[model samples]
Target: MNHTKRSGTPVKRSLKVALVYLLVGGLWILFSDAAVERVVSDPEMLTRLQTWKGWAFVAFTGGVLYLVMLRQFQNDRVMLDRQLGQQEEIRRLSQFQQSVIDNANIWINVLDPDGRVLIWNRAAEEISGYSSDAVTGSDTVWEKLYPDPDYRAWVLERVSRIMAGDEEAEGLETTIATGHNGNRTIAWNSRSFLDAAGRTAGSIAIGMDVTEPRAAESTLKARERQLRTIMDNLPGMAYRCLYDEYWTMKFISSGCRDLTGYEPDELIDNRHLPWVDLMFADESDAVSSAVDDAIAAAEPFSVEYRLRRANGDIIWVWERGRAVEDDGGMVLEGIILDVTERKQLESRLSEMATLDPLTGQFNRRETDRILQEEVTRAERYGRKLAILWVDLDHFKDVNDSRGHAVGDEVLRSISLRLADSIRTVDTLGRFGGEEFIVVLPEMSVDEAWDVAERLRVRVADEPIRVSDGDPLTLTISIGVAVYPDHAESAEGLCNMADKAMYQAKDQGRNRTMVFSQVAGTIESDKSGEA
Candidate 1:
């Protein structure tokens, strides 16, 4: 278009003139000598013009004719050369493009709006396992390439819209079967191609095998879903907090509401009361230290403390958190969990382990622990301490005759009576079976004896009632021991009191004996006092 006009007509005038000049030059050369001689001999011709002038005219005319023919030939040669150069360049470019397409790793295909293959490249040949001879000028591509005809139709519709100039075709990726055997899965990105007139020519598609990447992505998505499910359904609050004075909540799961009476959104980003605000002021330093240690060491930590609830109720809570660090060893992550229920359970279990379940009183271990602590206190404060051990009289007769259920009831009754009998400051625990022990702080032997007699009378006077039938009367024998005077340690005090109790039981039972002497003598023996 740029080189010249596009008419097919030849240069008629130029061609005729060139041929005529050639013929005239040949005829002149053939007859020029004879013709010159005849003109010289003519008398009339001599009168009008000389022979030499005629010869000069012939030479000039012949030369002009030859130059015109030569000029025309040179012009044709120039145009021919230009055309040949252009054709050669076009052929080289076509070869280069073919080589590129053949060697490319990207699979490429050209399709018409009807999902028919139009121009399939060499890359497509290698990938789809189909050659141009097999696929071109045919619609077999749709049958094999598009496993789902409906999906193919949907894509064709969209592509048609693009072809119609309704929209610019952009990346449209979808999974499809590809490869030489037609079993490989690949991801395809398709777009429409426009022709010289801005009209739809066909569609161009580029594809890559992404089966492995897609599988890995699917696995990651599944794991994310599982973690989300666990976090959403956990029984307690789990959260991440910033290591600051506020211990601000950074990420809190949905379960936060159940524990703190605040929604997850309310607590996140320090919107609601933060950890520092919710904790007891006295325990804040301890909480901070625990967190610091954990963060410094990238280890787990736990703290037992009190939490102030939204309703202003002080409730005990156990907080546990672990630190997560970056590759550079910086603590960039934190996980916090609510352990309130667990702490409450631990306290309850400790109580159960150390104290008798039925009596709600300290058991032997608890008694010994308190005795040791009080002995140290007594040594420091110079205060006197005493122990009084008591044994029930004929308590087993009630159990054996009436059933163990009644016996259990009797034990509970005795425990309650013993609790009521002791002073608020004094300590009492069911030692084992029907044996009871009492601890007195800053009390003399006479004071302890008075308290013991009071407890003894209370037990003897209380009528034991069984659910089966009738109420019965019971009695207790008492043995007294003064701490640090009659015995120096818990074991000695327990042994001396136990010996005294057996002596009271021996003196016909229901009697009080003081183990003040080595061969302890019975001081009081009243069977009918109650």
Candidate 2:
């Protein structure tokens, strides 16, 4: 009824419907003709049936056109569905990329081909003191980040290198001074980002604050310098020694030259004398024993021994060391110090306290110390210790007649005689004023009396020929005491022997006496009974 031109599908459907209509119409006409011929008066019925068939054929043709239009509409709907799915996928991928740039921990900043800031992560906002909303679309963002002219030029140079196919710029790590937060230094690692066309669009950088690490490195270097200074300026030798058979010196400070007259290089790495060879033979065992005790206890140790110097002088050194041990109680390290000057000063003070300065003999204080030491030895070994107290008779007369000089000569002569008359184990000391004390360790009272008598006889017989062309003869009255026999305490024994000497003086003034129950009894009378 519309009289419109048909489409290709509609035209094909029309042709198919028309062919069906023709076949149906022909069949109906034939049926009608047969009916007319059969019923001689059925011509009206056949014409009515033919008109109904034509109306049915028109309806079928309209239905075929509607079906073809519906199929085309369904195909168009399917294509629209596939296009919607692709658009959704593209939106999801864009959101994922944006989330990655926003949530990353490292500072990531991207710039467009024209050097305008395009994207900035959260880390970059916090570090650069500029938010993404402020920096995005800013063409001079890097200029604001780095204000120094030289630093900006350096960054541009690196960027140029990256654009010229140089991958070395990718690994570029450097410090930059940013104007933000009062011009602080930032360490950044940079890489070039390329577009879909493989052209370098811009650069992305990650940065952190490296000032603290740089300061820490500088402090470590300063501390090392201070340690070296202290080691170099120390007064005495400081050394690190190994625990091997050689006890090789691994490190020796510069003070080695002052202590042992050896250079530091000569001692380090066992270039010169080893530890065992440094000490005297007689003292090596004692030093080793002390070291062993220190190592076992993880404590400090000290020993006084004789060390041979480079000048062949046997200097007495006091060595103090500490043992450094591992968890297993093994000696892993050792630090040694030289105490030679301290030892010498101690020895000098000891000599001043114990020796008579005029005669170079042991004083009363020294006599007491020697007696106490001998007492300890006697108690330990079940041996006897003897002591002799000798006084010069008529020595005051020499001082009264000539002078103290002449008396000093006589005293020196007596001191020599007394020293020459005793064994090496015996101690001879001046007990002040013309009086002398002798300590004999591990000797019986009999042997002590013999030694005292010999000293007395020698002093009396030996005369001093003075510069005044006169000979002065003197005799020594001695008092002998035995430890644990005559007295027990050092003080008690000295007092007892002193009383015995006075007793001898009261009896004749030139004789040897022993402190006994009978006080004034002379045991030997070796002064020739005067």
Candidate 3:
């Protein structure tokens, strides 16, 4: 609209000037000629006056022409000055725009409709390692950047589609071969522009290098895979979880299935059940307390407790964990190992150390230790204590006749009978070959004799059965000794009881004898077998 107004103003001003000139010239001619004809009468005087009028007319017309020319020249000069100023401003604006494009950090390039390079900015030159003088006004830069014919074709096809308005130009990425630097990956955004006639002219593209970022991403992924592999191969379950009552799991390793009989997904975030739910009800509180204490102290924690597996079997587990700071809050990271086998082995080892393997009764060493402890307690409390030393009658005859295997069966049977005959407070142990000792606390001499008789009767009342032979009748000779009555110490009592047992065996087999300390001489009360 402004262009139309500007063009129309020049035409209107020209028309006004032409009409003024015509009107002035027509008025001057009509008025001057009519006045000359009316004022002049004589022929000679009229000719002279006409000549003077002609000269004045000539001068008047010349003056009018001169004024018109001077006004036109002034108008032309003003227009020319305004036009020159506008042209200078346009040149400065173009220079500024070019400076911005050339100095921009991002790669900017323009291509003609025929795919020839039209404008290549300084950034493009720096990124591509190709100068503007080398790339501009030619399409050969495309080949230099993309050496592979097929790849270049694909890139050109995409660009063509963008120019045709069939595909969006934003975020179109491509790899290019730089002139000096190695191949680099780039991300591109492009658009097509139109000329004054609204026809497709050329396209401009902006690119960003993404080579370093892509390399870093790839390295991170590889490291993640390595970490995952290590976790999966571990012998126990490894986990990271929030330090809460539920122990909300953030990550659980693949070993979860083998350790807990549950998949990792099943336990993560308490999807199926919380980790605390797997702990034994009685031990969970102690375990929680230990962890809390360790966390408060900013130290690592280790606890051994029982866990109820998915199949309802209880197993011992050892766990080691530490509190770690995370973005959200404090969390726990740890590993759990099944220690059930180790616990069972330890129990068996303890039994092996204290009990006789054949009969499962206290061995000599453990029996002696218990006797000493009972003696010490009785001495401290001034309570009476008694001990019975019993031996099988003619046990060597059984071993010689029935072989050692049958002898072992007989020994085992007799040991069970002796164990069942004694009170729970009494301790029954194998003192030696075919010999047993029973320690009784808070028992007097009479009570010790009674217990010794009962033990003898219990063994003699039944014929011990063997696995591969007929049952054989057996009997035991018993000896009784009381603390502070016959002996003051455990060793003294054992010696006294042993002497009484040999005396019973000497008198006759299968009888009981009680040792006495009257006048520092040994005495006995003999009881025949039942």
Q: In terms of lDDT, which candidate is strongest?
A: 3
Winner on TM-score (1 vs 2): 1
- Candidate 2 residue runs with Cα over 4 Å from true position: 1-96, 110-119, 133-139, 170-180, 191-204, 215-337, 372-387, 441-450, 460-473, 478-530
Q: Please identify model 1 stretches exceeding 4 Å from their true place.
A: 1-8, 11-81, 88-92, 95-100, 109-120, 132-140, 183-204, 226-324, 327-353, 376-383, 390-425, 432-435, 444-480, 494-530
Model 1 C-alpha lDDT versus the unseen true structure = 0.73
TM-score per model over all chains: 0.67, 0.61, 0.78
Q: Clash number for model 1?
A: 0
Model 1: per-residue Cα lDDT over 1-530, one tens digit each? 63344342356666787788678767765576556557677776654554555577587886886797698789989989988988998888778657775566777777776657776777778767778678877776655666788977775676677656576543455555553564655666666777899777777777776667878988999998998799888776677766667877777877766666778887677776676778778889987787788767767888777776676766676566676754544332433456667777888999998889978899889988988887778778877888878888888887789988887788888888888887888888888888888888878778877887888888777787868888878888888777777777777777777877787887777766667654555455434344
Worst 10 residues of 3 by lDDT: 520-529
Ranking by TM-score: 3, 1, 2
Per-residue alpha-carbon lDDT of candidate 2 for residues 109-193, written as tens digits (9 for 90 to 100): 7766566787888877766678889889986766786677788888777766654447544335555444365454456666677
Looking at model 3, the pairs that clash are: none
Models ranked on lDDT: 3, 2, 1
